[model samples]
Target: MTARHVLLLTAAAYASDPDGPWVDGGLVLRAAARAGLGPSALDAAERAGLERSPDGRLRLPGRRAVYEAAHPARRRAAHRLLAEAALGERLRPAGLLHRALAAPYPDSALGTELAAAARLPGPSHGERATALAHAAGLAADPEVRAGRFVAAADQARLAGRPHRARELLGRIDELTPTDAVRGAAALVRGLLALRDGPMADARASLLLAARLCPGERALDARLAAAEAAWALGDALAYQEAVAGQLSGAATARAFGLGMAAALDDRYAAGRVTLRRVVADAAGAGAPDALLRAGAAALVAGDVEAACRLGSRALAAARALDARPELPRALELLAYGELRAGRHARARTHAEEGLRAARAAGQRNVLAHQHAILALVASLDSDADTVARHAAAAQDIAARHGLVQAATLAQWALARADLARGRAAEAAARLGPLVRPGPRQGHFAVRMLAVPCFVEAAVSAGDLGAARAAVAEFNVWADRGYDPQAGALLARCQALLSAGDPVRADARFTEALARHERAGGDFERARTAELHGEWLRRARRPARARVLLRDALVAFERCGASVWAVRTAAELRATGDAPSHPEAPGRLSELTPQQLRIAHCVADGATNREVASRLSVSPRTVDHHLRNVFAQLGVRSRVELARLVDRAEATRAL
Candidate 1:
């Protein structure tokens, strides 16, 4: 069928029945637009008030007019015209009649006609007979009601209402003789078993359904069997069972398979398949599909894509008044922003999502949101706040058996401890997280673990262990899974510990670059402190003092009190402490050169451009900037920029 025809039919279906078989109207519109539908068609639809609802359900004011205009008979002709317009199909009365017969209807003749019109080559003849019998209220034919119950159960399951599906299936089973309907009962029982987490029973029941029914009735039964096999850790069996099942073509089933692959660490395969599902969903404008796609993007490290998809999902959910899915979309958006280094945006969305989840009594969502907040707090160097949020997340996860979330919370707690300089405590706290190897998405946890181990090794002066940890981290980094600024910073520290000043300086510079790229001002400040210490050890005391001072100022500005104090102590030891004791707290104490450099950097001008604007040679600008860096004790130009990005961000609070 033409894309336009598909979209029109989809729209008509949604308009005729808001709660219908097809759940995503937005996807259909997108597909139609992509297929080169003129703006006039969309504008006409819009004028008809079809696009007002975000969920894509039509809301036409003149329903009678719409019904008269798009009657089934007329629709059949329109479909023929559309096929000719888009597919170059030749008109045939038999074809038109066949298509018309396939259309869904309340009566047997219409249903039969539509089926014949659509050329649906299935044992639907039996289904049609059963439907006719049931509609005639034939008392002797028990299979008629059984067919109706099965159809209703299938619809409920497709709509994500598993409980309703189970209820209907139960009624169907009770109404039929046990021996006669054993296969149908087994299929329904299998689906219910899967939902209730009894994979073994689900697998057995579905196996029986596949054996007894062996045809159309076994489609869902086989898929359920595969899912149960997957859940039971029988990967080969699951893959074999779902390889050619009808349900395997479904988006939800594909998404489930992708998730299973991801859990198995087959990221490349998972990413490709998930992205396909996402693309299809996006094309169809499916909110749930968009939400799933956003999650997949996150797993693939496409934070920007995740953010966009997640926002779209949130809007779709809100339009549909789907309160349950709103927080999920919002949380995904918040995490995407956080990963993309949009801290203020992340914080705002996270807070909103948290409030919504809490209000809805969604403890699992609340816990995940809390964990995200804790990560943000850690980035801001709010150790106490991070600890509190992490503790709360841990408690919630533990109470609810959220093992994956609990692991992340534990990692966050370790981060808080490390921020407070309690390396030993952090290492101890993170031990379980590392040993368990994660039940889901272990990359983030593994990233955090390496830093904790390195921190403990460094604090105890175990250079060998530190080196080993850095090597292990390098493996992950090489594979492009590095999760934090600390990984690069740790590498720099290891280089410094190994007494390779040249490479250590180079690594430190790289770490500074990474921090700047990530917009991690706090880490940038810490990098500057390390660089300053390196310079001091190399007897470049003059330069060391300059970077150290900048680092201290930036740290204090970012609310990193511990690092600020440490940088200040380093400055004093180098005999290059600020001339004014209160200078760190007072912005005006900064020299003109420092202020000028800060302002230019914050404006995102390159150093050479800053030089041109300030009427200085690039070298002179670099020298002065280096002096500014030393005087302010900052690491890179990016950190300087972040320090001066906003008054509040840089202010000593």
Candidate 2:
């Protein structure tokens, strides 16, 4: 075998002696002998100082820098071996134990051990780490210097300075070079790339690391590469990278699994994984795992848990003062609040999140944050705010290919149009989104917007489109959504039957009941407005009057101007003035239906004649006229005529 192979075998054997000095050259010669090196090679190793001859016998170097720069497992083995020979022994006991036991047993053993112990060096980790650190300063050998650089890079990475870690790792080849050292450099570079981004290039570095690493170091590189694959959204790479991690930190691994599931839109699996990630004392986690967990909770419809986790994540981010992570934490927290119907608080969080994202130059997060703000504005019926933010968000999302954000912005803009009475324009904008497609996996997002889309369709007289939207939504509801989403689904169904007056009334009742079960005041108010409009169109003036008034109150309370104004108009059409609303009993106060009956009586038509013309029974017509006469304080048809004449004469005057 070549000298390098013998030296490698020697290092492996040195690392394998679980009970021996962690890094002893004398033990290495024995280990080389174990690898089949002959006495002559051992002598050569001794003369070459690889098996350092301190006195008459070969021994390991007293310093800890000897094997400290090797691959991770090897470095670990070296440190562990040093630790086993604790207190930084000046001399190794492995060789002496043998030499003493070889002599006259009891008599020579104690003396040999005593001499060995007397010559022992400091073997504590602090002492060895200190010695190894100083040795790097004095290291003139390129390989030795490279090892020291690797050691420093390890510390830098652990300390969270990716830039400094990169700087140290970059010098491996210039200092002490090996394919293994180069692999070590590559692994650190890949990890740094992941933590700080431009994640596109991380895969290449991690691939290089996995390829060049000699042993278990490949496992570390491959696992990190999987995470890089997830960040880049590369499915094939994620599969390969994930397949390599047979074992590791369970929580960290679960976090990775959760992220992969979330990317694939497998919410059930993702939620399960997230639960594992945050279970108090479970697996180890990265700094951002909490935020990821919170996001998963939000998507799974666990709003309360999502909000709690988000708060915790933001607090953790603040504690660390990690500017890059703050925006995502805030964004997640805002989403939770939005789901919980805390609109004002959600707006505040989203605005702050947007500012942080902009300052951090996080374009992806900035796009999502802007979408969030637009959605909040849309809820408040603030058309101007919705238009501005939705436009900005859509532009960035389109450029970045952030399909989710782009679609959400479209939803906000379309809803704004619907609120403003541009139903045709709203339906036109939302048509493509309501249908089933590749984007349909974003069930909740689409589900939330479908009600608005259905409204637009009904108002635009696109019954077919409205029906299709309701059908598509039914599929989602069947698969299951949260109760709030179920409420929205019911609301959409009610809107679909807008032309069928009886069915619309029944469905509107069902929908409002569902909303009450789910508890979103905004949705309840919006549904009320729709039901009132339907009732007014059906000529159920008494029912319409009550619903419209209640709806107006709700809309105003929720700050929904457009719906409030529309409800007011409907109230006026129900024969109640918007401002005064026809208090108790007043002259000339009559429903459209009642006024028609009054005119029929004023024309001197018999009740039978009036019933024939008005498509009602004579008794019904007589009864309506009696009520109209009572309202005007007139007892008979001729008296009603006199009252009508007086109203006409007053207008003429």
RMSD of each: 14.3, 22.2
**Cα displacement (Å) at residue 628, model 2:** 41
What is the C-alpha lDDT profile of model 2 across 539-641, one tens digit per residue? 7889888887788677666555545655655665676633422223344479988988766555444466578899998779867877887777665454454
TM-score of 2: 0.56
Report the C-alpha lDDT of model 1 over 1-653, residue by residue, as the tens digit: 24234435444333212333332344335435554665566566665455446656444444345545555765554433332332112212123332333344434544343323222332222222222223322223466556555554544443334455666566565465444366766786676555443457778888788767745556656666865675444556665655553443477667656645654457568767767766666664556568877876765555677889988988987775455567778888987887665656777888998887765445667777888788777655435577777888777665544444566667766766665457777766655444423343233455545655565556656666566556656655543332444446554464445477777777777777677665655656766887797788788899899889788777766655545645655665676523323233333557787678667755544455667788887677667777777766677644554344334233533
Error of 1 at 44 (Å): 42
lDDT of each: 0.58, 0.62
Give RMSD (Å) of candidate 2 vs. truth. Answer: 22.2
Q: Best-fitting candidate, measured by lDDT?
A: 2
Q: Which residues of candidate 2, in runs, are more than 4 Å off?
A: 1-246, 252-287, 438-444, 578-653
Off by over 4 Å in 1: 1-284, 379-384, 435-444, 462-465, 482-498, 516-523, 533-653
Worst ten in a row by lDDT for model 2 = 124-133
The backbone clash count of each candidate, in order, is 26, 16
